[model samples]
Each structure stands twice: as C-alpha cells, then as structure tokens.
Target: MKPSIITTLIIILFGLFTVQVNHRHLSRLRLIEVSLNKTAAGLGISRNSPTSMPKASYSSRSRQRHADPEVDIRQLANNLIEMVKMIPESESPKDRGELMNSLATLSEFSPSQIKSLLSEIHKSDGIDDELRKSVMGIVLILASDQNPRAGLDLVISSHDPNGSLMWEDAIINNALRSFANSDPAGALKWIEDNREVHPEVGQKENLEIALLGIAREQPGTAIQWLKNIDPSDRDDLAAKIAKNALSNEQRMAILEEINSSFVTSLDTTEMGKLKESVMAGLGASLDPDDFEGSTAWLENSDFSPEEISTITSGLALKNPCANTGEWISWMVSHLPDEALPNQVTKSFSTWTNNDYKTAGEWLESATDNAAKVPAISAYVSQIVFVKPQTAEKWALQLPEGPIRNSALKRIASVMESIYPGSEDAFKQRHGL
Candidate 1:
C-alpha cells in the first residue's frame, strides 16, 4: 500500500495538472458558447434553435423596411388641417376627401395627440380642400370627446363660410352643449359673432339650445338673443327655453316685442299665451314691482275680462295681499267706472269674501280716491247678502257719499228680505 515517495509525489503533481487543465478548458468552452449565443442573437437567431439566425433576421428586417411610420400621423394631421381649411382657402376637394378617408382609419392614437396634430395642420396655409375636409373629419370625431370644447373652438374660429352646412350645424350643436355645461359667456359670444351664419347653417336650434344654457347664468343676454330669432321657426320648445332665460327687465322687453308683433296684429290666441307666460313668470319671481309695467301693457291690450281675471289671479299668487291691493288701486283709478263694473264687482267679491275684516278696514282707510268708493260699495252690498247685521254696522260707520247711501240701501234690502216688515221702517228711520 505504501509505494515510493517519489511515485506518490509524481502522481499528486499529475493529478494537480489534470485538474488545472480541466478548469481552463471548461472556462474556455463557456467563453466560446457565450460568444456563439451572442453572435446568433445579433444575427436574429431564436435561442430555442428551431430557426436559423439569418432567416429570422431577414423576415424582421423586411417588416421594418415595409412599415409606414407616417401613415397615422399623416391621416391625423390631414384630418385636422382639412377641417380648418374648410375656410375657402383650401382649394382641392380631392385632397380633402382623401384626408377625410385617412382620418376615418385613425383609431389607434390618443385623441389629444390627434387634436394636436390637427391643430398644427390648421395653422398652415395653402392646405387644399381635400386636406380641409380631412381635418374637419378628425375634428368631428374629436367633438365627441370629454373635452370637445377645444374642437368646438377650432371650428368656430375657423370661420369657414364655405364649409358644408351640415358640418357647420354639427359644430354649432356640439359647441352649444359644451357651453351649456361649462362656459356660458363664451357660448354667447360665439352666437353674437355668428348670428348671420345661423340661418345659413341651419343653426337656429343650436342657438336656441345655447341660449337656454346661458340663461341660467346670464338671463339678460340669453333673452336678447332669443328676441332676434325668427318667428317662422318659433315653437313650444323655443318658447320654453326663452321663458327660462329672461330676466325681469328682459322679460318685459320680450313682452313689448310680443305686443308689437302679435298683439298689434290682433293674434288673440298668441297674445293670451304670451300674457299667461309673463304672468306665470312674475308669479314665480313673486315681485309686485316687476309687474307694474306689465300691468300697464296688459291694460293697453284688448284682453278679455277672463284674461284680465287670470292676470289678476297671477298677481295675487305672486304677492297675495300687496299686489292685489296695488292692482285694485290701479284698476279703480285708471279704468272708467262703467267700463269695469263687472270686473270691479268680481274683484271686490274676491277680496271681501276672502278677508272681510281686511276689506272693511281698507274701505274705512280709503281717502277721497273716489274710484275706490264704488268698488267698496259694491263689496259692502255683496257682504250684506251674507251677514246683514255685520253689513249694517259697517254701513253706519261709512262717511256721507254714494258709498254710504249704497250701503244703507243694501242693508235695508237684506233686512227686509230676512225680516219682511223691517225694510220700510228702517228706510223711514234712516230718512232714506
């Protein structure tokens, strides 16, 4: 088992040399394999070894060579430019059409990016009709985005007089909607600048919608626009929208317009509806002061008694006691006694029956304002029909005048009716 020391030493050196050689060989092999792999990958090889590097490289290179980088960019840019160029400056319909077609295919890019590209194109001059339409198409698509206002602004700013009327209508409508939910003042400014284009673009509806939106924020401005709208196109929808946009002053102005247009024309039905609307508006505001001018307007109209009654009812609802009193005073002072007897009687009946105590108090407080005397007398006479004793007490307090005499006669008549022998006796005692 114990061989010679030299033999053992030789064997150990050989073993050490063999181990070193093996380590160096393994290191070299790893280096070579790594180099081979890298070269293969650089040559486009699949590591799985199913395909050769050259073949894979050729296919990938071919695809890169064939790819179109600007296809999407051109399409988007063309679309935006086309829309902006709709302004007569762009002359080529064919180019615009092509751009439009290209834009229709651009669904991969972000709308904002597309909008940016379009904006760039819009600023460049000499873009033909074809490019303009393309640009417009892109703008149209973007008009549906959450921030379509940008597109709307571009459309409006373009001032494309020669553009398709249909496209103009769409732009105006989208702008109106955006304005309604956001910037009302901006929308009004747009309407003001483009008023002449409205009929040409069939944008009346758009204007109406926009005005309605602006009304909540700037009723005065909105109502002004509404007045300028053509009557030929007026409808319930327009009326409803206009009704909401008006301020007190603007509403009176609109009533003036309606009076000049329809009332003077003797359009009774239209005048009635207009009066009803104005009164309803006043009722909602509950401002008797606002109705003073309106009352005068109504007085000048050939309104039926029923229509006047309706207006008075509205006034009562607006400011119950206050408006009723003001309106009664106005009617008594301005209207001829004979001309409004029935109306006075009805109003008196309403006041006295609803609040006899208040009516009696107001009667006693009234000064020589003789117009109110007949009305007061009528009310007293009517009251005597129900409460003879109360009416008789009130009659005795009235000052000497037609009112007092009328109250006395009313009391005597009622007393005789209730107690058959009282009328003549009472008349004798009262020296009637």
Candidate 2:
C-alpha cells in the first residue's frame, strides 16, 4: 500500500491551497470591517478610540467573546459593525441576543465606543426594519447601565432616516434606576441638581429607586430621604422601603419616621388605611428568625393603641409565635372582642403545630385562668385536624366554665367529624 512520491506531493499542494483560501477569506472580512470606520466618519459618525487593544479577532468563530481571553477591543470594534450588516431578520432573536450580549460584555470598550458602534449600525444603509429593531433591542440591554452622556450623544447625533429613537424613556429610566442602585447618594443629588439640565428625567422613579437602594445599606438615611420627598409625591414608595425592614429595629425606625410626619390621625379611616398599609408591609418583611427580637423591641416602644394593634396583628399572622403570652394578655384586656379576629388565635395554633408538648402543657395549666379561654379555644381549632383524640382529652380536663364549654363545644364537633356519631359520646365523657 505504499504511495508514489508524485501522489504525496499532490496531497501536500491541495492542503496548502485550502489554507491559503481560508486565510484570504478572513483577511477580506477584516478589511471590510476596518474600512467601515472611514465610511462612518465621512457620514458624520464620531469614532471613539479607547485605549488601543492588541490586534486580535476571536480565535474561535463561535466562542463566547467574554470567556475567550484573546478577544480585544480593536478586534471587537469592527466585529460589531460587521455583525449588524448581516442581513436584517436573517437571524433568530436568540442568535441576535448572543451578539448583543457579547457587545455589552465588551467592558473593554468605553461607553463612547459602545455609543459609536450603535450609531454606525443604525445609520448603516440597506438593513431592513426588522433587523434594525433587533439591533436596537440588543443595544438597549447594553445601554441598561448609567452612561447618560454616551447614550444622549448618540440619540442627538443620529441621522436615522427612519426617525427611530434608541434613547427612549425606557432606556433612560433603566440608566437612572441602575445609577441609583450603584450610587444612591450621588444619584439622588444629581437628580436634584440637574433638574433644569435633564428636566424629562423621571424624578419620582429615580428617587424611589435610590431610596430603596439606600434602605438596604443605609436605612436611617433612607428614612430621612423619605421625609424629604414632597408629601404629595410619597405614594406607594414608602411601602417599598418599608418592605426592606427585615429587622425589628429597621421596622421601628420606619415607624418613628412615619410618626414624625403630619399624618398621625387615628380618627380618620383614610389615615388608618395608609398606616395599615405601611405596617402590613413591615410585617411581611419580618424574618422568621426575628420573632424573639421583635417581641423584645415591642415591649419598650411607644406605639399608639391602634398602631400597636395593627402592627402586632400583622406580625402575629406571619408568625403566630410572635404573639407570646404577654401579647395575648394585652389583647384580652384591651381588645376582648377583637383579639381572636385580630389573629391572636393563629399564634397559639401555629405554636402548637411546631411544639405541641410545650403548647399542650401551657394550655393544660391555663385551664380556669381568666385570660386562658382565647388560647384554649385557639388550641382546640388546631388540634382537631391531626389529633382529635388529643383535643378530646384536653377538653375533658377543663373545669365547668365558659372556656371549658367553648373547648367542649369545639372538641365534640371535631370528634364527630372525625368519627361519625362520636360527638355525644365525647360530650358525655367530658360531662357536657
């Protein structure tokens, strides 16, 4: 099977020809890409020359631009131009998204470079509207950060024959929101200072975004910011920061700020709705592990009666255990008719589900106690689901009284539901 020398020489020549052809194709692409810089400038596009990047193209045609270490700005500057020239709508959005994502990942390109690249693509002739939309959509994702100068520059300078806007309100809002998250203090100050400069900026959105960001890192500062916003402008924004109150300390801080405001009217239903909304948000923000800490803080705080009622009830519903015996005692004496409906019963019910031994012991000892009926009634409702027999045992132990009768009434009903016709027998056993 030995080949002749002539045959081997022929194979070598063919291999060399293939390499030369491939190299020529790539060189042609580079030339076309680089020449766009000249054509773009003549058409009034300002080409940004960021720090010179080493001359390179993605070594692999399909490799991710970010993950591929060899990718450089000089290579990407023209690559972006060529990518947009691909026949409009010829590629799926997913494919277009990858290209757009790669462009955004080019952090090596200054904001100016990104803006220039986008402008060239938009102004480039022969691209279909569908393809232009795809490019515009991708550019929006890239422009999601705070680069107002570069973005505004492109918009103002664009000679887009189609009258398209790449720097619309959504884009600016995104930039402002992003800037606020990154630099809340500076961003808010900028908004206040630059009102005349960027009058169209959504000041409300910007302040709300900045306040929410500040709430996480500087809650006390956020409270002051909340106070400073025009009262007419303080709609649902407070609820946003209020929801960040994961700790009792943060929630109480928010309440203190609210109390200092002029809306401390307990006599009006409108005021109640506003206060209730804020307290409800704070309650939902509470961490399950903060149950003990919340109770300890509630003891010393000077919350008004209505505020305390709504706020504590909010906490009790999320985690019934937060309504410890002292809380139930306060509710019974001060809010007898409203105590159970306010969901104090839910606290005892939840505690029993978690630690029945402790809850059962607590209930057994509280029999015949004045403030015990609510707790006992709450317990009977919870136990009837899994352990109707256990509920019957607890009910039988109750001495003759309203609470005992309430317990018997609940237990007998649950037992009959569990075992048909057992209610009378259960009542007889408990001497009902």
Candidate 3:
C-alpha cells in the first residue's frame, strides 16, 4: 500500500501538537509530494524512501484547570448502580474477557451511559491490565463529546500512570478536536492558559493544533498566530491550513499572510506542497459538467489549458520544484484526456531540452502508453534537432497511427535539408 502524503504532514504536526510522539513515525522520511501515479507499472517514487521532535512528559505537578460543566451526580450514580446489576458473568474467563474488550470499543453511548459502561468494565473479573487500558482509552475519546472538560478530567483520573502514554496523547488530541469544533477561539485560549500545566503537553506544541483549528474558522486571526510559530515550521503549516479554507479567495488570503515565500525560499518538500496547491487550483477550475460547462469554466479561470501548460512547464523546467513524471500523471488524471495531450506535450519538450536522461528514461519506462503519445512525439521532435536518427528510433516504435505519423513527420521535417522529398515520402508511406 502507498504511504499517505497527508501522514507525512501529520507527523510534523503531531510533534508540534503533542507529547508521546512515536519515534518510528517521526524517523520515517516521507516525501511531501507523493507520486499519485503509483500503479503496477511502478509509476511513483520508491516505497521504501519517505521522510520528529521532543515531547512533554507527564508532570506530576500538572493540575486540571478547566471547570467541568454541571452534571447530575444523582443520575450518574443511578446509572452506575443499574450498570453494576447488568454486568455479565461467565464460567469461561476468556468469554468474559472478550465481552469486556468489545465494551471498550463501544461508540454510541451518552456521557453518562459511557461512564456507567466504563464502571461496569472495571469490575468485570478476568480482564487484564491491557484490556483495561483499552477501556480507559475509549473513556478518554468519549469524554470530549459531552462536557469536554469534565470528560477529560474523568479520563485523567482514571488513566493509570504506569500504562501507555500514547493513550493519554490520543485523549489530548481528541479533546482538542472537540474543543476546536465548538469554540476555536476559546480552545486556543484554553491551550494558551493551560497547556503548561503538569501532565498536559507543552504549550507551544499544543498551540499548533489550536491555531490550526482557529485558522479553519477565522483566518484573519489564525494567520497572525500561525505566523508567530517558528519560521521553519510556518510554510507547510500555512499551506495545510489554507487548503482547508472555505473558498479559493479565503485560501489565498490565508496564504498571503504567510511570512515565508512558498515559491522562492522553501525546501523541495514544502515547494512540492505548493506545486500541489497550484495543481489543485487547476483541478478545481476543471469542474464543469458538460462541454459548455468547460467553456464557462474557461471564462472563470486564470486562462485556458495552453496558458496553464506553459506556466507549469516553465516552473517544472526552471525551479524543478516538483516531480516531472508526477506532473505528467497529474495532467492525465485531472484534465480532460483529449485536452491534456497538447498542453503536457509542451512540458515534455521543455523537460527533454533541460534534462534528457531523466525525461527520456521516464518516457521509456512509463506504462500509460496511451497518454505517452503526445509526450513521446514532443520529445522525438525536440530530439530530431540534435539527433534525427535517434528521433526516428523513437518514432518507429510508436503504434501505427496518428502519433506515429506525427513523430515521423517531425523527423521528416528535420531531414528536409538532406533529402528534399523526405517529408512527402513519409506522409505517403504513413497514409497521412
């Protein structure tokens, strides 16, 4: 299975957002620009190559600061009593343990219902520390649902310190998500005030998460806070948040506030993310439902395929910000098939001119043979300038049709100085 592009981004986020970060997950060097073209043809980057940080420890001195929302103690106490009566008993301890494990994954219960269920799971005989831990994890996740602060407190109180710290980190993540959904600003404020509290993850780390949340709902303030983050971390974070904004204008507005230049100064991986953003913008512009709809989109977009193709081709050749092969795949995958050939062919011309080996190798190994024609033709035409025989070698292997005819014609055109009637002869032979 392909490793996720988003997972690479997420790991970077996790370190700036939580304690108990996974070292293996951190150590993996994930490529930010995934080769979405990966197929049985070995289209994408090699799977083995991919591409963290210190985390806060549980501080015994940390204290719970958020006030729990009002709850009916009597109702919780009553549910707990009734829950105790329903606890299952079995002669086979394994059977009983299986039942407890399922209870840990329960998803639909209310806050009180979950509380009662947790209490019952605790008293069940034959359940081990590991199984008990799973139940505790569920409690932490569900705690954020209703009365998040209280739910979190209960989670904290129930969590055994000797057990996995990963669970506590998961709980913090869940609670933060919940807080962000209801009151992003408040959530940000809460993290600022309480993140330094003992047992809580570091304030700076959690601030990234809170800022992300607020950024989605209120970009104006969100960008200000997000920019204040360490300069090195801001670019990708800006791109990630901007991608989720409600509209193109909003996405652009958010990114416009970014301190670093995504186009100019960022590393290759971050630049790859920028390339994806531009590609996505181009994709979104392709969203008309019919032939006329495409015309309508053209009226609305920056320019038509020719213009975008030129821009992308120039960027690919100049900065080399993204993978050229993947760019070809992206064009084929997202743009209309008939519409893409000429546009991408333009890119192949530039790519062949700039770095013949990589471009030629990709064209050779690429298995989307149908999509390869225009590019092959373009490369052959360009190669004819320096090596007409080499161009003929390439053109001869093309399937017996227009692409072959086109490539042959390009070779024929180049041979005109040496053989005056060569073009006519080629046209006649190929029935062109």
Candidate 4:
C-alpha cells in the first residue's frame, strides 16, 4: 500500500512540531521537508548504482514513467536512515511518522530500486538499531498492504542474524491487519498454509489481530470465518469483538451486525456470554455527562434484568469512585429483588477491592437501610478471603435478617477453611 494520507499528515505535522523544538535541528528538518516537496528529489540525490540489488517488480506504469532515470537507491536509503536518526531519542510518534512518509518517496523508484533501497539500509553499517527497525517496520506495513505474502517474506528476511525479528509484535499486528483489510480470506489462508513453517503466525494474538481487522473491514463474513477457527480461539475472539464494539460509532455498527451473527451462529450459553461482553463494553463506553440519556436508552431496550445488571456493574467497575450509595439505590429501584443481591454483591466486591477504606466508610455511614443490608452482605463476602477477621466484624454489623444469616454463614465457611477447628468456636461466639 502507498504511504497513508495519515502518514503524509504526520510528516507535515512533524515538521511543524520540530520547527518549534530546537534551532539546531531546524536546518535538517527543513532539508527533509524540501526533499519531500520534490517527489524526484529522493532518487536524484546520487548517480552511483547500488550493487547486489534484489530482483523485484514495479508496476509497468511507474516503469514506463521513470525509465532509465539517473538515480541512486543508496542515496534514497541514506536519506531515510538520516531522517530516522534525526528524530530525538525521546521524540514522539510524530518524528517516526515523518520517517514513514518518506517511504512514500519509494513510489518514484522501480520495485528493484525500492528493494535496493531497503537492502542498502539493511546492510548499511553504523546505523542506529532503532532507525533500522523503524525503517523496516514502515516497509513491512507498506508491503503488507500491497501483498501479505510479500509482507510475510519481508518479515522473515528482516530477522536479525540471531533469528529474532525486531519489533515483532508491532510488525505482526500491522502486517496481519493490513493483510486482513485488503484480503481477509487470503490473509487467513496464508496463515493456515504457512502455520507449520511459521507457527508464530497462527498464534492466538496474531490470529486475533487478523480477525479483528476483518471484523472492522468486512464484518459481514467475520462470524462465519470465526466459527471455522478452533473452538477456544473462536470464543476468545468473539468476546473481544463484542467488547471492542462500543469503542467508536463505526465499530458500534459492527457490534450490532456481529450480535445478530452471534444469535444465529452461537449456542445459548455462548450467546449469553457474548451479550454480557457487549453490555460490559457498553457499560465502559458510558460517559458521565450522558448518563441519563444512556439510562433512558437502556430502560427502553428489551434487555433482560441480568444484562441490565451486568451493564450497571460494568459502569461501576469502570469508575469505582462513583457514588456507591446512589448506584445501589438506582439498582434497587430498577432491578428485581432476585437480581439485586447478586448485582449488589458483585458491584460492592469490585468497589471494596479497589478502595476498601472508602467503601467501608460509606457502608458504615449509609442511611439507606434498603441499600446497606445487601451492600454490607456483599462487602463481607468479598473481604473474607483477604481479611477474615474484618469480614467477621462486618458480617456481625448486618441487620438481623436472612441477608445477615447468609453473610455469617459465608464467613463461617471461609474462616473455618482458613483456620481449621475454628468454625464451631466462631459460630458459638457469634451466637449463630
């Protein structure tokens, strides 16, 4: 694929940003900017031909346009190397993006010339390790977009002498994503076909990246494709699909489509988990400023009590600092009693784990008897393992009722297991 418009924008923006960084680097940045302005400037820098240039193909259109030009691939390679090295050790992505944009200059070179340029950079001595890796990463992305097989080959060839591929994670992610975006089936086929030779290509994380790219670019077929993978892999990738849906508006569309697919393809248990994941994603997506509108939407929707509870718990999990009392009060008003206790327990467990001091203080000062009973019960249930003695004290504070009895029973079970022969004494001491 050609250098993205975003890469172009990064180059422009980087020059603008770097102009403000230091005067010493100003001349160098400006020179790079000027070379960018001249599309032919990259190739025109030197007349000496590179030795041992790899054989490759450029489109006939490009070949016909720049046939027999005076160009040095080494000069182009050095220019890219210099630009990357110019980026400060602590420089941000902007500088790196500028380096990427420079790769676009390769469009002016023949495939052989581009290969020669990369080869020169690869073989060049004394190049900074980061500069070489960054340059290779950009090439990998561009090559993947054009041909995933070629991208994979480039990746394998780019490995260090020690057999470790530099920037493996980032390279795999971008390459697989590029492959999937352009040709999902081809990408999957490549991975499956080459799995024996390159087992890492078929690993879960790499597969997830490829599948997610397809989910975004071609959501229509993602479910069917996912179903064909290993059962364990499918479930994990499916959950990720649901959880990632609410990240943005476009992905939300994918979420809806994928939800429909899940209903059709997945079994009841799997579908239920998928729904919870989606609700959790939705819960995380909630903005405090838009809570009322979001709640209104939820209330009008046809979600079950369990799903609604999951969403609220998700919201609480996302922001533990949210007022626990108000959250409990809202759930009490909305959720049926059957779901209330479990949801309260789940939410308070999460809150207590995050900030027990604040959570315990709120429970102590709580005025709403309706919220406190279940809240205290849940708190004790969660803290029992980590703080058994404290759990006993909290359990005793529960009001006299089934909730209190249940909390004490839970504490007894946990404490007895922790300290053998202490169960009867504890029950007797608490008058249970």
lDDT of 3 by residue, 280-323 (tens): 43333332223343334334555545444533433333322236
| lDDT, candidate 4, at 206 | 71
Those runs of model 2 whose alpha carbons end farther than 4 Å from true positions after fitting are 1-101, 124-131, 143-178, 189-208, 216-236, 243-253, 263-269, 279-296, 320-337, 352-361, 367-371, 391-432
Name the 10 consecutive residues with the lowest summed lDDT in model 3.
28-37
**Count of steric clashes across candidates, in order:** 14, 1, 7, 1
lDDT of every model, 2 decimals: 0.51, 0.54, 0.51, 0.60
> For model 4, what is the alpha-carbon lDDT of residue 97?
52
Q: Highest TM-score among the candidates is held by which one?
A: 2
Candidates' TM-scores? 0.33, 0.54, 0.40, 0.51
Clashing pairs in 2: 320-347
Provide the RMSD of all predictions against the true structure, rounded to 1 decimal: 29.7, 14.9, 16.6, 13.2
What lDDT score is found at residue 322 in candidate 1?
37
In candidate 2, what are the lDDT values of residues 25-130, reduced to their tens digit?
Answer: 2332232233333433443433332211122223333432333444343455446545545414333434334443354354334556666566666666666554
Least accurate stretch of 10 residues (summed lDDT) in model 2?
5-14
How far is 28's C-alpha from truth in model 3 (Å)? 30
After TM-score superposition, what is the CA distance of residue 266 in candidate 3 from its true location, in Å? 10
Which scores better on TM-score, 2 or 4? 2
Candidate with top lDDT is 4
